[model samples]
Target chain A: MAGYQDLVLRVNLTTGKVATESLNKEWARDFLGGKGLGIKYLYEEVGPGVEALSPENKLIFMTGPFTGTIVPCSGKLGIITKSPLNGYILDCSIGGSAAVEIKRAGYDAVIVEGKSDYPVYLLIEDGQVELKEAGDYWGLCCHDTEEKLKKVYGDDYSVLSIGPAGENLVAYACITSDLYRQAGRGGVGAVMGSKMLKAVVVKGTGAVRAADAKKLMDVTYNAYKNDLLTDTNLWAYTDGTPMIVELSQTTGILPTRNFQQGTFDQFANIKSEAVAAAREAKKGCVSCGLGCGNFTRVGEAVVEGPEYETLSIAGSNCGINDLGAIVKFNANCDAFGLDTISAGGTIAFAMEMTEKGIYDFGIRFGDADKYVELPELIAKREGLGAELALGAKKLAEKYGGIEFAMQVKGLEFPGYDPRGAWGMGLAYATAPRGACHMSAWPVADEAYGEGNPFTIEGKAEMVKDLQHYNAAKFSLILCDFWALSFDIMAEMLSALLGEEVTAQSLEQAGERIFNLARLFNTREGLSAKDDVLPARIHRHPLATGSTEGKTLPEEEFIKMLLEYYSIRGWDNNGVPSGEKLQELGLR
Target chain B: MIIIELRGPLARYGCEHGEKGRIEAKADNGVTVRQILNQVPIPLQHVGLIVVNGKKGSLQTMLSEGDSVVIFPVVAGG
Candidate 1:
């Protein structure tokens, strides 16, 4: 454990136990860390048949060897647990000081198990751990709770906390970090809440020692320089992802009005220019070279993101085009600790339900002024928000509007309208995390020529390859944004770990994680049937947008799934076969 | 004559936002996005996305009048 401290901190809330364990080196080598290691621990500790929100579930927080190092965008952490929404393996990564602080606190990972008899929060400082009473903090939103913790602790302590949404166990609740960053999707926060843990406050002044500091710095600096020169990447860093509003709208892939159409004419209202114009300031993650996070000021309020997904789902998808409202919604999701994508998706489903006469509300598209009240109601799980909190899959199931749920595997689709870009649809269907856009963003190819997005010419190959690559990047705790190319990542890995990890090796590591996740899902009874997109994307053709009249044919989906499974060495039903498991050393 | 629109950083050198301006060129050798960039004296490589008529295209994509083109840089991460 030269690069790693070989330590994992374990907390049993029920018994008020705080202990440390040596790293399982064999598992470490095979699974790596972050997502890979987290999943390994989760699979071993929690049975698949256990209810996601039950006391039997465990939440594992992890950081990779590269985390806290000079590796660019290595400041990321993964919160792994069983998902209440998808009922499958859930691992969500987020940027902030949390992962770096955790690593510096002298542990590569932290596993919290069993429910506490009372509300509590974990505090860690240089390996010292404590379970503090959280009775006064239980019902507060994430922003207030974070502020209260910072006041009691210190501003330097990195905090991860949940809001009423998680405490209420809203299926799509997210864990909030560093004000606006989130380990969003799959109800990680709800799992945390179920354990009666309000937050994890961490402060660490320790440093991450690379095997070769000089090499690591040189490689990291080289990446920083390269990223500065990348055009699209520069845009992302400057305007944030919301800069894609115009592009997505123009392409008709913005997922408007809950996938009723892909394009929105009011996209200009939420474009990056509008957002940047409204911004009061900007910021980014710890040690991040590019400062991309936008903090906008409209009236007296401040907010983050409205990023592409939030703007699409909350704005165009719900027909609320006002940038101010979208920004406010994003901030609400952060303060209240909700996943903006899921929140937006759920709200959009409700709007569509209202439109179709299945349900009635005065809601209409582009009515940003009115939607402002929705998040507050949703966070408290009151009125229509209560039903919306059930998540799009459950809502659609209840309301007989399943065709327009715009979800896959029970998780709602993100901002990208899959109708225009077919690779994204495939990516969503096969993503281990369920309907996640980042698992593989093939739209970069189809939309911008990073690869061939439309042809499906090499899509099966591209999708499988990218999925593993993303998993590896996540494991290494690097931002998938800055790890744009494999060559750069291989250099970073080799430099930091003093190992010659080639692009092929990195891809192999990603494959290992992917298959391990599939095994977890299989053990949970998920099958090829669980891997699917909403009917709108596969059955009903869109009448407008760049992909007008184009729907991903079901046969193509089946073919792509088959190719993807085969590429990953999985069985015909998308489960990891025994030989494949052994190949990844997971067996 | 053909026109294209620049966005984000690339918009700094452009005449207008979403405005169309024609560049004279031969039919078969119609000015590519690259040639247009050369004439405009802007850094084309800084562009992360080039959409021609709402389809993801590149600088190698030839320009044509009546084509609503938008060139942008990368703007978001996971």
Candidate 2:
């Protein structure tokens, strides 16, 4: 309550009108903030059967308590809406200045409803908000759009814009920001485009004061300044996340060639060193001294990425080891405003389909030369890319190869191959936002030997705990990488809120958020059967490495899920029980 | 004897490149992977992915003759 501005601007684009509303203090107390708050809003507004891409679907961009604070890695902004990709409650958070800028703009969140008569962009400067005509910016790619907006609004305004992909309503289109980071899951961008909205530009110079600012600042500064000494943060700052390339591949969980294999033969080419060598310099999110975003020098121009997901999907999964080609493809996706992981996964699925002779789509793994132009084609809805833009599961279903779609709950898989890590398999299947890794990342437990990746003995408890805590962190809009130690995090939160927020309370908040997401999904018709993994993960054994001859045992997974559900206060069917919901004050 | 090249964080003191190191002593006296690491001046705690002859190998795995090893530090990413 102390850090919050206690106000939100609701814009009804159809009527070109804007109205301000007082913050629901009770809801804030119940849901906390960020993804949790956004879901609460969606649950109240959207009904069970509303079409995701329809104008009826409301898009909420919400941040949290620590967003504008001096917390480390607090640049995440959550995009909450009914996803066209999966028809589920989508809470995709991206790292950028948008969350910070919006929070600083004297508001806790921005909720846009109804359809605009024409393409438009929202400009929020402090308390003043304007809906600007985006007729000229409609057809522009994300990079150009951001450049134009920045030029117009100077360097101060943080822009979250969609490109040709979103404009065309590509199912996996991304909402790009800072020309790099994106809310890149589900079809949130498609929902944005469907409403005839293009971008949200914000520039706020206002300051946020926490309940105990001095204590908060002191605690945060000590941790932030000492974060380099920590294992995860230090490693992250040194090599960026792409350094996991060798580790994952060596661990045999790299999700190679549409996840047919765990390890890649050409792993060296997609290594962090290669990515670093290809880059101009490190880049990342707002207020982040550690710039993890890569600016790869591919021939004539320096472009972004071959980040971990992009590297796995575009490189090993696609069979393309050429870092330059991967960089170019990643940059191409960025410009076109498409999710690179989905694009890469979709293309990889297509290539696999092509290999099976199911369709002569002319796709193949490692065919970097051919796929460099695929992003533009997908954004423009051209060629086979039209189908590719529909995302992996749909493309696979259309091509009659749903078995190897490499998707979970209609969302394409991230980088980790489940065979190599069983915990990741559970995480993928049980994630609230489809196949997202962030929902409950068991990477350390699964891939790295941090807490034992292979042991399913106590993994259910770990996953449940992580899911809850992470959900809570998402409400705080903090980076999961920095949530290395929950005890430290609890102390920080307590210091900021001047509340006795123990680890248990944080876990409880996360549980509440998780249940709320489930509640929304349940109301939207997601049943017990929806919680499932692809057949490939169940049937196939890892071809090479430490986990060779290993697969996510179906019975083990079922038992794990049941145990997870039990811990989550859910029924045998994985639905949150009435008692549990009541306990969380959701009922 | 297998030679292990250490890179990234392991090459802390000397250079920015990987250290061209050697593992002269083999498993003649039944030396385990952990013991061989102890023989080396540098510690193995930070090393994450261990590649022995282009395949994934753990610390428990015994060293074989003529094996080419690559030791990487525990870094980030998935």
Candidate 3:
């Protein structure tokens, strides 16, 4: 407990009461922190088959030992909850100053349970907590809500709030934090909306201490000085993720026109140089040496990045590549508290659906002007937005075009086209929360000519390894861009916890965490059958591009699955085996 | 002449481009990406993605007549 506060705060909206509980030391040791600890508590508390957006389900916001510490890029909090969109366990880690604020608030995790009779917001400062009436703020957009809250509670306070999208229960509604950052994907915001919770405003003046402060400082500053400011990482440091616009474009994996194409012709207009032209300033999270977040101005409105995902989903995926307009779309999604990935994906699906006569509307693939109305409508669940609120999976099921739905396990795909990049295909099909790139972005080795993306030779094993690595990283609550090796993480953990830990031990815990997640999902009625790619991925061969005529053959998928299962010690159907459970100490 | 384009940071190594990422080089039949890159001033390690005629090609892949090549820096993501 040297590095940890060893405390978890629980708020019950039903009774309007608050309580603090001691952390389970053994479980904390085994699971590490952040998502691992959060899910462990979630599994024990929630029922075997509880409704995702019900009073019985709990929403957890957790931080790792490394969080709020001197470690570079350590400012991340893992949000874990039952997903209303996918009907599965969902974990989305939001980065920025908010996470470090949570850690400094002196709680390892915050759990919200039960439903309030009226709309409410939770305020936590130092060790004090309260539930306040949110009557006046219920209907405002995220931008307005943040502005209002910051004005009321000094500018020093960090706020995480949901907008109209969450208020109306848009399935993929996101929680906006640090103004522009989000705990997006799999409807984390909708679950909050279901509980009648509007926001969590936090401020902490307390300090986060490490066990060996001197050693930690030496290691931390060394990493900050040397590793972060490299020529290799210069692109990310300068242009942020939109730097990948050209990577996805030239590599022929940009998800364009609803994944009907892998390359966008107007890619240059949306790439980094174009985005940098509009960037007025840059910002970083607490303790971050390298800033990947840019404060970009698109005409009259100044907002944070419409990152690669936003650019692709709203711009190229819709067959519109106007950078300024994409930035506007990003700001709109942020204000409405919508997941740009799912929102843009859903919009594209609608566009394609309309093209196929499923519904007659002005929503077209290449029309950026008309799509402006869609985000507001979707947030309010009005007219065509009601059906679109079901996300691509359920919408495709109800209308038609199940084949073209850009979703897996009810969650929409990110910006990568599985048709062009096959590693992403396996990663998408098997991702715990559905098709998320953050699960394992092997594009470094897969699509960008570092390895054979077209082959299944060792992809299953590669994915298995990367998944375990990311699982551990998520548990540690580190940013994906931290790019720290396991050895450094082990050292950091060992120093913080005042214990001896090896890189191998951390990796083993990662494997254990993933298996437990599988066990949770299995009990939640998920199985290997649910781990599937949309038919469009298997049926529609790309007519042009680097991945021309490439489709994942059923046999290849089965073969890869079998190998993946073998590596994870799972059965033929992707269930973790008894021996595997025992080996990971989960039995 | 062989058509080659250097994008973003890689364009500094390229000379005389009317476009943002365009570069032109003397033609050689069945030239590989490595051969064309050897002639460019940028270090081979600094170069990451190499695309030939809209298709991803490696250092060993041979380029034919009328093929357009695009060279990019070592950045991969999203």
Tens digits of per-residue lDDT, candidate 2, A1-587, equal: 67688988899998888989988988887677899999999989988889998878899999888888888788889889998987789988888799999989888889999999799999999989999999999999998999999999998789999999999999999898888888888878899999989999999888877888888888888887765355445555556678778878878888788888888988888887787676677776886655666667888545656678888877898998888788788888888888988888889999998988998778787787899989999999988777788887887777688888888888999998877777787888888778988887777655666556665778888778778878888887777556445666777787877787777777788889988888888777777688888888888887887678888878888888888888878888778999998998878
Report every candidate's CA lDDT: 0.80, 0.81, 0.83
Q: Top model by lDDT, which number?
A: 3
Estimate, for each residue in A1-587, the C-alpha lDDT of model 1 and write its tens digit.
54576899999998999999999987877677889889888888888789988888889999898877776667889889988876789999878889999988999999998899999999999879999999999999898999999999889999999999899898888998898888888889899988989999998888777778898888778778876446556565667777777777766677888888878877777887788788777787887766678888776567766677788887888888677777777777787888888888888887888878887756666667667777777878998788878988887777688888888888889888776777888899988878998788888766654554445567778888778888887887777667467788788778777878788777888888888888888888988888888878778877786668878887887888788788777788888878887877777
Candidate number achieving the greatest DockQ relative to the actual structure: 1
Query: How would the candidate models be sorted by lDDT, starting from the highest?
Result: 3, 2, 1
- Which residue ranges in model 2 land beyond 4 Å of their true spot? A450-455, B1-78
Interface RMSD of the predictions, in order shown? 3.2, 3.3, 2.8
Please provide TM-scores, in order, for all candidate models, with all chains considered together.
0.94, 0.94, 0.94
Model 3 scores a TM of: 0.94
Name the 10 consecutive residues with the lowest summed lDDT in model 3 chain A: A227-236
